[model samples]
Target: MTRIALATASADLEARFRAATGGAFLPLPPAPLPSNPAHLFAQLDGAPAPDVVVLDAELAVDHALDLATLLDEQCPQIAVVLVAEHGPDLGLAAMRAGVRDILHPQAEIAEIQSVLDRAALAAQALAHTVAPASSDAPPATGRVISVLSPKGGVGKTTVATNLAVGLARTAPNSTVLVDLDAQFGDVATALDLAPEFTLADVVHGSAARDSMVLKTFLTLHETGLHVICGPPSPAAADTITSEDVSQLLQMLSLEFRYVVVDTAPGLSEHTLAALDRTTDHVLLTSMDVPGVRGLRKELDTLAELGMLTPARHVVVNFADKRGGLSVADVEATIGTKVDLRLPVSPATRVATNKGVPLLQSGGRDPVTKQLRRLVERLTIPETVTAQPDPDSRPPRHGRRRGR
Candidate 1:
């Protein structure tokens, strides 16, 4: 029987998880809570290492971080998953403290189980990779890309959706697009695929850690792109914290070669958590004055917070010559070079409105070609491509901003 341990402070939550896990649930050992969390190491010194530790973030953020750090130092093999009520920012903090996965207080049993299963697999994989005989082999590290924007209505979702499809089309490896915007996500509608299971379904199920619930929840697009759509109801968003997002990303990274995350606008907890887990952050903005100004402010904030990394790239979406601001002027104002510029195409809006991806129409359109080139530049390192000049002239802006 699998030995699972629940370290949550809530009796109701413990009972629910116990009922769901049945006989596999292991009774948590009696351990006194330390008034000073710095003594946590001493308190758990002789205690048997849990296969999985489900910590409650409500107890204390600092305590949670301390516990995660202690667990990593004392029992590096043990997998830690945190449960919190806040958004992904907390999850990112927990991750920084050494937690492998995170979940919200209201996370479904199935979702918890999926996280547990993935954690177990990751632990086992680590053990095997570290074995004396296999020590010479290099470990596998997957790529995690985050799609972000400072302000809303900048076509971040469209860019994310098309970029994901474009990557899947260009690369032979498996790709998964996760809608992290739990409140107002439209990834499913954009792809025109109605999935039988949403992320909510996976979170609510009672399947074990090794169950197929997670794999089954993903909806495969016509372009062979797999997506995990956000919850249907906005009210459900409150239940999804930063920790949950972190856990989901960690699990997805194991199975996918490329994971494209569509984040909500602004620097919410969820957005921060996504950024923390991401290997690359794609900053999306338009040619509008307010958009450029907002992007600059957001980038500055990220830098101030020490969150900006070398992998962060600025992507200019809906680039048109007729736009009021030229590309150079936009870049000069923003104080950042535009890494990739996606041309405005009328078919993009039509495709989105009709519930289809632009890539599905064909790979021949100028916009599609640019999108494909963007993906190529991202994936291939040896191939040197010319970077667009920040001072370069912008295409003429048309009557409507073609997304």
Candidate 2:
């Protein structure tokens, strides 16, 4: 059973969480607030880390950002859910400080359940993905790649789907695409496949393991590709646990050569779990200043949590030569090199409108070719191989290699 730590000062909030999630997992332990915010981190130091940490925004904002930072640093894998009353700035601050998901106190029980479910899944995924590292295990069989963005509308889904299709075309019998954005998944829409089933079905079903349930929910494209679409409805999103996603990816790694997960935009519980599950993470961004700034903040937060591995790749989608900011400007601003640049095409709209991916539409689109190249670079055997001595490496690599 998954364990959660609720750090809210409000008795009503705690009661609501307990009442809503009581049947889902083990009874939650009483959350005793430390004498001060500093003691909160100390309290977590020696405890058997909780799967999820739910904090009151009142506590977080009143306290320094250091508290959130400490939680992120001390319990890097823990999902930090922030419960707030109102105010957009509070949400922004929590997000900037690396809180996983934000929830209003007035949120419905279903929303709370969804958050708990997502936290559980993320924790399970991290555990499953890192379990092999406890032993002197060999390298993973397949390449696990994650597509992420700090803010939405950066074409993450489009790039992820096209990359999966490209990898399948370049190296058939070795590519699988997973949609991790359970709340707002667009992978199926992009691929134009009305899958009879979804990831939620696989999770809610009695399937023993990810591999056993994979074929049941995954739809095969005419291009010889495979895709595990997200939950059919937003309401079903929370039913999928991080463990389910992690197990699903673990099974896919054994079956396919390449696994590409289209993550939700932002470092939500779902996206964090996806990042923990994959060997490589690709940050997708557009040319907008706010988007670029958000990307930088995300990269920094990931670095702080030791989630930004050396294998992390940054891809600028909808890149245009005529854009206001050049690729150089974006790289300079983000303090990270842009590995891949996909040109903006009017055909993107046409393809999406027709419910088809650009790569499958028989269009000689530059963006399609660029996404394909990115996949090729990621799936290379040399790139997929695990490091020999992980301890001497950086924290991100150690986390990814499970050292």
Candidate 3:
């Protein structure tokens, strides 16, 4: 049966709709419709999303159209119909917003039934076109690799970009890099990309709901690596929520083989949200006393929260023989094995300045070679015997001190 939902305040219209659907339609709150599709879905209260949504234009035509437009983009499978007094202007606007049909305010039960039947058919066609044929095979879930650091200037972005590019080379068009460093992120600049859209765009609109729409928002790199750059400005970052980051990462994991995330310095809420979905952690830090100590604290915190993954890797960047801090010192300080150490090289700075990754340049430099090793380490899968249940984990505390 075709499921229907309605948003209206008119008793007359509600009665007619109930009769038309034979009490089968779900009625939403009368006024102040939700701002977006997500908010609307939240009102379902655990029920499945309806196949058709009917909006009454009497309360607010503009709000109805806006909601219709979002539904058109985010949930294309749901057919939208508007109830309004028919006019040339309203008809044109409704059509532009992809409303399936327009019904008059005094529509009778039979008329409403006829419109609903057509809308249901349209929705069925869309659902079939969007989804593939059913099979016994399980749905594919991609690997989510999040590169994190306790402080800035530890070559985190450099490693993330290189790893993503390397993976893309190995599996072309199968990798995506997401810069979760929202405020002051430089992933776009590192790749010399002038993005038409950024992370902010991907999390807020149709991109957040549809994998195909999300892919269109990503900025593609020359190495066949797709990227979701950070907000264009710090102010723009404020609009994104931790929930947005969580949803974005979940969607990417379903679409790509490797979802490489570049997080900000320290564990911000956004970074923590990414970690919740992460399968591996590339814990990076610089070769210095303070940096190493900070990394220790970060590791301790993650462990306490039960967020550490079995595939965790500790990477020490800017290794120097004369720095007096050996790899042993780092491993001892962080209480973890040093999985990889990248030597300091002038080539790294040059590549960053030119918006190119060392891996993309195919350099034979030691830094480049170490980065390749890190990528190889990731390629070797680690068996996940178990995952700590997030709900059972300890509550977070004092996480705001560092950020």
For model 3, the run of ten residues with the poorest summed lDDT = 383-392
Residue lDDT tens for model 1, 167-264:
78865447889888888989888888776556655443331122123554467787888888878887778877777777777777766778999999
TM-score of 2: 0.60
TM-score, every prediction: 0.61, 0.60, 0.67
Winner of 2 and 3 under TM-score: 3
Backbone collisions counted per model? 16, 4, 0
Candidate 3: residue pairs that collide: none
User: What is model 1's C-alpha RMSD?
Assistant: 15.8
lDDT of each: 0.70, 0.71, 0.85
lDDT of 3 by residue, 272-384 (tens): 88888888888899999999999988888887776777667778999997999999988778876787889889999999999999999987999999888888877765522
User: CA shift at 72, candidate 2, in angstroms?
Assistant: 48
What C-alpha lDDT, on a 0 to 100 scale, does residue 274 get in candidate 3?
A: 89
Compose the digit string of candidate 2's lDDT tens values, residues 1-403. 7777777667677777867887443223345334332244334433444677776666555553445665565445666777776575776777777677777887877889998888778877766764455556765578788988988888988888877888888878678888888989988888888876677765543332424334434678888898878877899887877777767777788878889889988877767776776777778899878988999888777766677666777888778778798988998888877888888788888877787777776556787677666766776756533332233225453233233
lDDT over C-alpha atoms for residue 125 of model 2: 74
